[model samples]
Target: MTGDPLAPRAAPLHALPPLPPECPLPMPVQALGRGRIANPPRPTTPPNMAWRRFGVIGGVVLLTLVATYQMWWLLRGDGIDVLEGLLLVLFVALFAWIVQAFVGAIAGFVLLLQRRPLRMGMHADGPLPALSTSTALLVPIYNEDPARLMAGVQAMHESLDATGQLARFDVFVLSDSRRPEIQAAEAEAFVALRGRLGANARVHYRLRQDNHERKAGNIADWVRRWGGAWPQFLILDADSVMSGETLVRLAAAMERHEDVALIQTLPVIVNGNTLFARMQQFAGRVYGPVIAYGVAWWHGAESNYWGHNAMVRTRAFAGCAGLPELRGVKPFAGTVLSHDFVEAALMRRGGWALHMIPGLGGSYEEGPPSLTDMLVRDRRWCQGNLQHGAVLPARGLHWVSRWHLMIGIGHYFTAPMWAMLMIVGVSIPLLHAGFSWGHFSLEGFTPTAWWREQDGDRFIAVFVATMFMLLSPKLMGWLATVSDPAMRRGCGGALRVFVGMLLETLLAALMAPVTMWVQSRGVAEVLAGKDSGWEAQRRDDGVLPLRELVRLYGGLTLAGVVAAVAAWMVSPALLAWMSPVVLGLLLSIPIVALGASPAAGRWLRTRGIFLTPEECAPPPVLVRATELRSPGTNGN
Candidate 1:
């Protein structure tokens, strides 16, 4: 059958009518036709990616050898028995658990306790006064769709206009692009964005010619330019999206809490177009409430700001978070790159509170679209968080707070240790036959907790561990979400949302191993002094190649074998305990590969599984707006 010319054969897909004139997409920064990238030329050097691979392989090999050697050391012990060796493993595991539990519990309790002080949702009491002072909103951009960035800025500006709140808040575009083309394009895009919302005169854009400390320097430049005027600043990432109403509330909350130098909203993930993104978005929606609630209850004033979706008292950050240059440093030290935690600690040191509001609304952020993207991001973050080690022991500071920072540093370090520990830990039983107890001397000391070593029903224990580690707070939060009368009224009903959350949680579980493994490898590599280098993440989600996947996660294949053999030959209890880590390692490449693969994604979608949040719009917010259509809701 011939196609109708006007109806069907009218236009090619690429030449088809655009998504909408009102919602125009910016040109992707990647090169399309030829050598001409819409933005700038990428570094031809591949940014030490090979070094990263070599370092990771070397480090993993070294780690395995170290773990094997330690196990050997235990076996060769001249005077020790198997019982003592078992006791040692159990002791370390228990200690780690206790330390984790203690830290998590404190965070959860802090989140639960603060309701009134950490105000959220709409404030009908009238828009809070914009301080006579000025503050800038910094949105840092690398290689992203300029269209989406403009859209976000426009949305925020629209929200502000709706509430007449732009006067108090100034928005700034802080570009960290190296390519001259990107810089020029950003300038042009800035003009287009400004044209869309000229009333947002407070909105400003500046591109840094030299991105010294990456994002940290981007903000520092602003502080230097307009520091004398604005007393506070709000930092947002390229993906961070906040409602105008919420922004005002943040400014107001900052005003109300004299001690609060920074206020962070646990960003609600939004716009998950790809399955990976959607899964993350759904998970955050479903399981995030309780975990965030519990965390907020415990953290109280000690809540840390996660860089973006947060507001900061500028003067305090400048004075305290002034990143000191590292001494004798090439890989680990130079400039303070991850300044969020340090900045929070610095604010606290200056006697200012940094708090997280669990109930903040319309505050959104996006996640990486692929596993490779995530691991690449993790390399940078691991280094930054690990860099906290360089500052934790500074003079005349609260050791307890420093403990939190150090613990965070430990969090990244533990990935490799945990992976190795589980493998060696499970293999100990089989290795018992090889023991002579004479080659190495034993420094036998009783552990703080000893029951973990004794063989027990570990399958059930691991199931509990999985849920607790991944989904406890999510479930708890869902169960307890509608307890507040105001929130109950605000969200319309809890049941549907709760159901949405349950589905979100299950999907999150499947995705967790993928995230953990990637992060684990990233942390391990960064710890071994591997740099991720300067490459802009592709903003648009795209397909992943199998060859690339194998290259990225091939090493973890050994984990599956180790786990299977250990399960069959060694203790069932040990296997059960180590299964997730081991099996996770085993499936590492597959997970990374599948996560990155468009073909795999298509199959998943074809089977109707793990739908992402961006693919589906969020459930409409239950807002109680009087006068069916307020002037604020009217169009331009």
Candidate 2:
């Protein structure tokens, strides 16, 4: 796990990085990733793996047959034709899934179709309204690789300086870290950066004497202290960075649009040294465009605020941004840890526009370098987002806006529901054998008349329902994003976008059930009062061990096994749809793990088939200079 000051402190982080004072200038760029391979003869999904996946389907089919026979026997014994009775359960589940898919997909499509907002910037013509106004850029940090953290922040500072916009912005380093040692390190680092930045960068540093709501409290304290004097502010995480130009543009946009309370940019992911990070970077680069673009279209004035990589009008945020503590304890109550969503809502409620500026560039963030790290992060986010769900119902917000708020909350909920689908899928056959039709049991009791009316025909309805339930959301996201050019950047082209999306979907499909299982377990543990313990994620820096991969993806593999076993016991056809999930889980670790070696990254890049985002192009100086050695790391 990455360093967590608040944890038991298994690894005590130094107040400063372990790097010796004279330790070389720039760290050598980490090992290059598997270069993306473009249209490299759509490779086969390995035949040996097929058998295991097929085994799941074969089980589902076998169960369906047994189920069919049992239904026939029961109905005949009851002296009734059983065809309709057998198909009813399958039909109902199918109908529910299809309806949900269609509605969900269409909503997503509409969201995607609204991607034209990016063009608004092109017409603004000339330099951004020259702003005399001053704003503060806030970078909140904990236990991160201070060197890398400094590098990222410095890069942004330099970019701003490079653009002659240095005078317009001042930067602050806010730390909530508890370990006295790391604090000592950060203080030293601040001194170094301050001297290096000089007057061009008015860098300031502060460690919270009291760490209350983690991040939000950190920001609130800043606001209470000096926000009253500033008109605008930019918030960033330890690993986040933005181009000076983008910062200036955002500041200008905020200045011009009096109604706009917040202007969030779609940040590209960078510093993906591990194979896992590489793949994530590639995926975000390729497929993320469409999603971001599509989302911007429908979002219009109602954009989501992804806490960091965004600029907020200071007066607006401070006045309207007070986050309410949730009503209970632990997970559900206390400070709204995930206060970004709520802040956006409150801004909108204040009649301020919270819009995403798709045209902006140079905004970037980093991903956890491994699956374990990713899940660790997700668990915390899940708790924060779930807490949002509790108050959304009666929050006096617009239905569209409220629904948007709920999506964050709903994300964790979906995992558990998905797990239930697996259990329910297993039971469908047993229900068929006894009841003829798939009907609800009333209070765990079926009326005698309902039982007697059973007649069985189970195959067709199950097939239709399965198809509808699975296909809806993808089709919607696809249709929504493909039409927008901004969104189109994520994919190679229109055709490429569709193909890539499907490929990604195929990958996600296989992974979904597995993730659901992992997430469900995480959610359950959390609900049962398990503390995730605020662990920081580890970065891969290009070399990853297979052992770590297996350990990380182990649960997913187990889920596949569990699914295969269930299908073999119940219904083979059921396994076919479930196959994607199984295959994904089984391959999860490897696909991510093995993909990051210098050898693989080189190979992928050779083919122009990659997973990194388009806008995340490595810095020009970094790209052009190889002798500089390393791209230093940050402490998060």
Best by lDDT: 2
- After superposing candidate 2, which stretches have Cα over 4 Å from the reference? 1-126, 393-395, 433-503, 540-566, 569-578, 584-592, 595-602, 611-636
Q: What C-alpha lDDT, on a 0 to 100 scale, does residue 491 get in candidate 2?
A: 41
Q: Residue by residue across 1-636, what tens digits does model 2's lDDT show?
A: 767777533222333222211211111111111111111111211124334324433444554554446544544553543444534344343344344334334434554465333433422225645677888899888776555566666767766776676887878788888877777667766666655666665677777888887888888877777675557899988767776777887787777666677888887777665445655675665445545654554465667899998989887787666776667556676777678887787666666667776546667777876555676788888777777765575344544457567777667866776565445544443455453335322222222223344432333443444565466555554555456565555444466556555655555565465567678887787677565655445554534577876776776677668867754444454455356666776677666555455566555444444433342345542332211224552221
Writing each residue's lDDT as its tens digit, candidate 1 over 18-116 gives 211121112111111122101122221123534533543344354444443443444454554665465456435433443344335334544444544
Error of 1 at 80 (Å): 5.6
Candidates in order, TM-scores: namely 0.71, 0.71
**Of the candidates shown, which would achieve the greatest TM-score relative to the real structure?**
2
Model 2 poorest ten-residue lDDT run: 23-32
Please give the lDDT score at residue 253 for candidate 2: 70
Each model's Cα RMSD: 13.6, 14.1
The TM-score, computed over Cα atoms with residue i paired to residue i, of candidate 1 is 0.71
